[model samples]
Target: MAQRILIAEDNDRVAAFVEALLRHEGYTTERTADGIETLQRIGRSVPDLLLLDLRLPRLHGVDLLKKLRKSPVGNDLPVIIVTGVYRGERYARAAQSLGVRHYLEKPFSANALLAAVKDMLPSCVQVDAAPEEGEPFDRHLYQAFSTGFSGTFHFEGKRKATLSFIAGTPVSLRPGFRHRDFGDYLLQNGRISANEYDYYQGAGHFRSDVLVQLGCLRYPELLQEKLAYLTGELLEAFSGPPLKVEQRSFPLSPGLQLFTLNMPSLFHRGYWRSSAPDTANPFPEEVYGQFVAPAAAFYRHVNFLDLNEEERRFVSQLDGSRTMAACLEGASGITPLLRLLKTFGMLVFAHEPLSVEMPAGMPLRLLFNVLEDETGPGGDGPLESFSDLVNEESRDDEPLLPAEPPPVLPEIGDLSLRVRQVFEGMQGKNYYQIFAMEQGKFSFDQLKTHYFKLTREFGPETMMQLAGEEAGMVEDILATVTTAYNTLSDVIKKERYDELLGSEKVGLGQKGDDIFQAQVQFQSGKVFLDMEEWDNAEKALQDACNIAPKNGDYLAHLAWSIYRNPQHGSSPAMREKVRQTLNRALTLDRVPSAYAFKGWILLEGGQDLLAEAEFSKALKLDARNNLARKGLREITEKREQEKKGLFRRMFS
Candidate 1:
């Protein structure tokens, strides 16, 4: 039972940003683009908090707040004003007068927005109260389908159906539509006469089976009719009057027996067949913003929708060149179809005002100053310090490519003289330390927020804006944060870090450091190598390489392990994979093991001359290397046999 939040903003980007941030924290959210719609949603059901934008289309921010205060439904609702339109002292005073204490200007940091939200809505007000049967049916149905909800959902009220799902996938469901019984189905389709149906109806439970015995219904046709009847029931349940739903975990709760039902098809056909509004929220206000198709990878995930030829054509035309309105012209069922696309995340309406690519980040520095002045002493009443909105550049950072692992971070206060002050603060810190979090204290979502907070503050534009900071120094900070994020964000890598942090065997100065952690993994991989556990060795060694890619020894062992892994069958693809890894190892440094492995691959491929050359290189690097020596021995033996055959043929 998550606490719900309403985002009332006309700007799609801003609303989307706020919605994502809140939902990540386990809050249910709804977005409205105008004052009238916002009030309409509130009158139906009030959210725990309202993130109101100042310049709403149908109603102004002040007017909306004024109406809210007088309304019986939302009078005491908490609010945080998020906007770029209103920022002057007069607006601040006007809002303050109306008891709006939390105000965030546009382009505010995620921290600023979240902090304001957290302060006003201190506790998550969970609503476990099931809606009056008809309500939340559509909402829960969409949620269940989209999220792959697992368990039994008992739908009651006007109709009844029990649905059973495994691992969030529906497998069993009894159709609630009982309008047409088998007899009615048979009579309507002219399979049996009216009098025959009446006689068959009296035959009771196994009427269809009874008909098969008699000449009234053929077996194949009967099967088809039965399927049609049951499928009709399923569709009727989905498309007809809303039902009250009771959810219980599967196996523990009484469930309908397993049925071979294609839930996705049922959902798609049911959703479209029924007249329920295809979307849960108001349509996007970005009219001029052209409609865009979702990327292929994203679309593939929901390809279960299995669009027909017409739907596919409609989607193909949404190539970011034409507005949705323009597409609507002469288009039939485009509204529901478009809404369906958006609801399922198959389309992106990067509307007008702001493109889909970015959020409007207004500076928060000015608002903070304004608030500070307004809060001076007794003037502003019960507020003192408040959230500062983040102002960052609209562009995203380039994908971080793996580079040579940096040096192990030193302990703080034991500083580096050459490093800039900004870089110095983080030089000795772990990922958790960078975000001011204690180990294991935060969720992954919280980790993302922390990572986002640092990245936003140190973004290119913001970093350059800082007095005396150079590009190289900014790069240093960004790299450290990015590396820390990469480690602590991954489950396997994070576990290794935690294990490394806890171990007492670490070097005196290198404890809790990234480079030292890589050393730990490399040693672990070497132990796996001793046992000939190639799979385990590859994983551990790969992790080491990830942490310290420049270490030739680590890379060489990883390549050898990959080559020897039993799971990878000896094929051209496998050989190439091994060689690519060895190439990386050799590029880092001329480790004898790397050359020896390369020689083995060449020998396996019958490239005898090339194998000999590689073996020579290995021997030059390390004469005692057993793999290289063995390879040379095998090559000499083959040549001696060839010489013997030639001499024998000549003498005869």
Candidate 2:
């Protein structure tokens, strides 16, 4: 079966060309003119690969790529960027940041397109061709033989250039076009005349606007001729055949400038070494080149005891020749290997392979299962036996009885069934599907829009009935409706409810025990106080206190509720009791209510001065308190008649 590749390009010509190229390469191609349509097609059935053009009619390429990465289906899909406008280094950097695997500039040959496709598809094979005259040799094929390496290569030809690769992928390319910086450096170092530098920089700019702005060379002819000369010079610097791996020592400190040409083979051979810096080269050794051989060898040889029997059997069939497609054929087992290889970095497609190392001494159980068959039926080895012993011992030491199960009240009966039904219906739908809104991030306004739509669908009466039900599971639905109303009304409690629903744990059922205990404590405390049992009331309040220590209202209520109990002893003792309890309550929070309550107790206990001061303080804090106002009036009288007499006397 051919791999499906989706092409998202607005230009008809480019789309047709890409579709044809992919079809010729044995890929099942699908084309969409814009990002919106492309996304819709992906939702229907996600393609195995995506060939993205950055400049689409509706959505730009970078935006489309970001959207694809954000979606579940398209997140990990391989993307090849095809762009006509070369933004140079800036564009290249952006594409690399997005994890783009391959890039094709405009006017690319069919062969170049095919090479890129081959690089990304692990199952595709490369067909060799001879190098043309003055063309630099391709040394990528020799990468399969070495463990790892990094080095600079000088290309000697009509055009001199330097290339750098990291882990088998080209990271930097230099001396293209006019080599503006390079020409400047040469002039500064006396390698070229000032006149030559000025002429070349100007000439280079005339041919390519970017080069001219960069001030590297003057004329296109000069720049091209210089590049050709530099290419030849670099080629001459390659003392041996194009595909040779040499381990040479640097004159600088060994730690400073160590370089490896092909290093993947070394890792495969278990030649693990710390990659540290040296003085000679600031950059670490680059591990570019083919990794298929080493990856295949590791998969074939490593032992993975952790894998299940089926997984092991799948792995045992991994001979180097079989592609992932072949291995997954006729078996529903390919999904696991696809995930495992991706994790192990052993799965390389058409582009550069990533360098992911398995931790030292880590079991290869997951990796090996996909490569080999299980040993036998009773494969419980020493390690398994030891693990079983440890589990048994831990179990035996655990407490015999488990913690009390949560109260199974009738709060969540048929509501669970209704919620489960809704979940089943919306299983694969986006959140927008439930509310019939377009897919997007959840916003306050969006929440209101959906809330109103749901209200209209379910009807106001049904929604009210649902809200009144004891169904705790319907909290989220209630929250959404509440949020909508609160958005228009600005209600604080409803806003808090909305925040609580957004939390990972839904509903107040988890805290039911705590609430029940607090209720029990308050009820018992009140009952004891009514029965004149002062000590019992205190004990009951203490229990409630344990349940909710931070509640100042509860503490104040407990103090007042126990004040006049007969068991509190005689009047003198009761006076001291009132003072202590009121003092404690006042210390907790000096609210107007607390002060008023204390004033009444003080008045009853014959502390007139203290009582008057407390009432005045309460009234000062809250002018509308009727109790404080009445108390203050009783202590002082009005003088309206006296004022009238004084005014009449003054006039006479």
lDDT of each: 0.62, 0.48
Residue 477 lDDT in candidate 2: 44
Off by over 4 Å in 2: 1-8, 11-147, 155-161, 165-296, 299-316, 319-652
Error of 2 at 120 (Å): 27
Candidate 2 structure quality by residue, lDDT tens digits, 532-633: 677888777766754564454456556665565656544333443454445545544566755776776665544434566888888888988776776666
lDDT of 1 by residue, 70-128 (tens): 88776778888876744555556556666677778888999998888888886435357
lDDT of 1 at 161: 67
lDDT of 2 at 589: 58
lDDT of 2: 0.48
Top lDDT prediction, candidate number: 1
